[model samples]
Target: MRLRAVRISRSPLLPLFLLISTALALWPAAPSTARPASCEPSVPYESGTDGYHTFRIPAALQVPDGPLLAFAEGRRDSAADDGDIDLVLRRSLDGGCTWQPLHVVADAGEDTVGNPAPVIDPDSGDVVLVTCRTIGGATKRQVVAGAVAGSVRRVYVQRSTDDGLSWSPQRDITASVKAADWRWYAVGPGHAVALRHGPHRGRLLVPANHSAGPTARSGAHSIVSDDGGLTWRVGYLSPGGDEPLALNESTLTELPDGRVYINSRDHDRTTEGSRADAYSADGGLSLSVPFRPQPMIEGPVVQGSVLQVRGLTGDEPLLYSGPSDPGERFRMRVRASGDGGLSWRPVWTVSEDRAGYSDLVQTGGGTVGLLYETGQRTYHDTIRFTRLPWVWRLLPELTVSQGEVSGSAR
Candidate 1:
């Protein structure tokens, strides 16, 4: 069977771009990054504290020097993925030290609406959120296998013009983004990216994953919009079959040199690590480099977040937040790569608790904000936000694979 694939851009400068990227990717990480002494996290949503059974899949987005908006799936009666879930949000006027009250951005009344992958349209400073909507009766696995009854899986979007104070209602965009044969679809369980450079500059990208019928093998793609969020299209579809790239819960960031770097969860876990990465030079419209396992950056089978943060002294490092412990979903570690998405070294571990899915957003200056699922018992108990100082760079000093001490910094 023929597989859906992206049309690779044939720019004359493509070879030069690949050469630069390859050098950066292979360059050894410097062992000189400094981590903060402690990450005093602020709980934005505690399970059962806000009349909800749980809060999971945290996604945070903020424009430059703007208010920090934190988003999550508020499960009403249970912690299960398929249930009465609403896309809830909170705002932080100051970095991330404090947060405002909870607000339900989109609620489909007893149905599920989540996976809030929010992005800012830099031209108008508008916040656009993309989420997946489905019936509460059907599980993700059931939907993937094409055995769903009521609304299997759909896509909805909302825009906030007043800095997250109110949304402009949920508008369905499933028809344009999802293909005919696609069985299961999901938008980012985290934040999206707005391109600032490259030929497709000003385009907004949402990295997503979907499954097909007959076999239900998962595949990753990019949902793109060129004219703000007014219109959408399927940008690229990663080639399927026997590549060990059954990516799920994908996240992306625009590199310093105007490229899209996508990191995804290996749902099938066919490789050694639970994560794989690729590069898209043509703004996420296609992958310049296909997905491959990144063994240096370790994590469990969980949703992770990545962002390109600006350092205080002109450095632009790509920061990734995920569980450092490959054995279990604990030791939420923050890592950084000075040369785009080439190499990574630890900045510091958030905690040794049962931490799992996490998302990262730059909170201005040299500090970064993290919204993650962590608890004393299970990762779904509560979702909290913390700040990390991004002062220095890193070159792998040690390679201790036990836990948090995966040594890039300390």
Candidate 2:
């Protein structure tokens, strides 16, 4: 898509048009140059192009320095799940216009490390990344069933003090966050949010998923840090039930009442294409409302993202991104909500072709940035970054013409 340049009139004296016409006749009009294009995408990672066979599970965060850091899993062998996977990142200083070279944040020889969940601390201006790792040979199915020999899934935390230019060594936090019965665990495949209002103003909440069952299934949860990234503790884990009741891979947004609104991926076949949502009142210690479907959001049980854009005084409109079609992962679209997340309206369609697993964030300039997985055929073909205009730019334009405009065109 091409972006049209905006035209602006610099002359303020419209009534003095006769006087300005004398000067305009002497000085020819200056040549017009196009403003930089918007909504253009840059590929941060592509399979087979960067030595890795695949790059999946993207997470993005814009640090205080104004550079966007995009995280993904670099799979070395093939598009399959279990392999020599490492956590990698790409940096973009000028919104999403250009990208820096690949930077591997965490690599463990032939081991698997992925699912980057990053949150920036408002007070300290530091960024923390929480991820999961496992042995190279172990698959998620084997880990979920507890068929593996020893502890399979482990959690780790790392920090970046210099605006994602460098990172500290990984520290294991499995014992503090994971239960003994849980086998399959994963941090968010998206970015986490920090609270800005009410009692839990500075709390950092990271959305996550785990599997702990007599029947062995998956459920969604959160891990939070109050005193910054120095420490972390377990929050709430969703209660599991019969078939079509399992929830996983969640995204979070802070409500006006200091509660967290979670939108989760449903694993049960009964619900099929819909997502389940819940709320945490006690700062994610437990759920105030259990997981249930909202008819407004129709997704194919895939991971989606929610972002709360803050206004000058308080919470503003909330944004959500996912596939518009309930049956397939196509028509990647974004929606907006005025009353938190109760109702939604389609803001824009990011892509009509194949797309999956997107994370959204408001950039420093107030424009929205989307880092997601998209391709022509498969989901893991490439990781891309897309920028969107603010709400004012998307308002409907009223044009008067001699011919009647159809309602469908409007």
TM-score of each: 0.85, 0.84
Best-matching candidate per lDDT: 1
Q: What is the lDDT of candidate 2?
A: 0.75
Q: Over the stretch 264-307, how does candidate 1's per-residue lDDT look in tens digits? A: 99987888888899999889988889998888788788889998
lDDT of each: 0.78, 0.75
Instruction: Please list all clashing residue pairs in model 1, or write none if there are none.
Output: 29-395, 30-394, 30-395, 31-395, 33-393
Model 2 misplaced stretches (Cα beyond 4 Å): 1-39, 240-244, 312-315, 391-410
- Candidate 2 lDDT tens digits, 9-126: 3244432343234334433342221112454577888888678989988888988656889898999988877879999989988876788999999998888999899989888888
Model 2 worst lDDT window (10 residues): 398-407
Instruction: Give candidate 1's error at residue 171 in angstroms.
Output: 0.5
